[model samples]
Target: MRKNGSNGGRAKYQCAKCGYHGYLQPAAPAARYAQVEKLLAERNSQRSIVRATGVSRMTVANLAKKSAISQPTAAAPAAEISPAQALGST
Candidate 1:
């Protein structure tokens, strides 16, 4: 297919399983996660992340947990892997 010369043209997609169709949305979970990681790496605060990325604070907190960010919690020590264990050795 050729471009329609429109500045805001987006590819339309169809789902065969559900018979769903829609234009592709640019912002996605993985993209948001990557952006969050980048911003977090820069030492940005949660509020800053939420404001800049338009992601909710709860979502940011969830992503932080999923990313295994170091947290000073009582359970944190339980999740640590010894050097030998990390190397898959006994």
Candidate 2:
């Protein structure tokens, strides 16, 4: 197969023998993506995630941004008051 440029960031290949053309499969598998996500969820730094997962820094950063946007913000916990405060004694 010969290189036929890229489409949507994926490399396209053309078969020299049979005239077949197709995009190359992703280099990283789904499990690798999951592992990256897991590391991100654990609050690991993007650089650390890249080093640990062997994924590119850009990939980790993109995933982190995507995850950040998708997840909803958590509400802060309500503060507790002492019985005396509640009774307005102080």
Among the numbered candidates, top lDDT falls to 2
What are the clashing pairs of model 1? none
lDDT of 1: 0.76
The whole-model lDDT of each prediction reads 0.76, 0.90
Q: Which ten residues in a row have the lowest lDDT in candidate 2?
A: 23-32
Q: Compose the digit string of candidate 1's lDDT tens values, residues 46-83.
A: 89999999989999888777666564545544677799
Candidate 2, superposed: residue stretches over 4 Å from native:
1-28, 76-90
State TM-scores per candidate.
0.46, 0.53
**lDDT digits (tens) for residues 1-90 of candidate 2:** 999999788889999999899987755667898999999999999999988878989989998999999999998988999999999997
Give the per-residue Cα lDDT of candidate 2 at 25. Answer: 70
- The weakest ten consecutive residues by lDDT in model 1 span 1-10
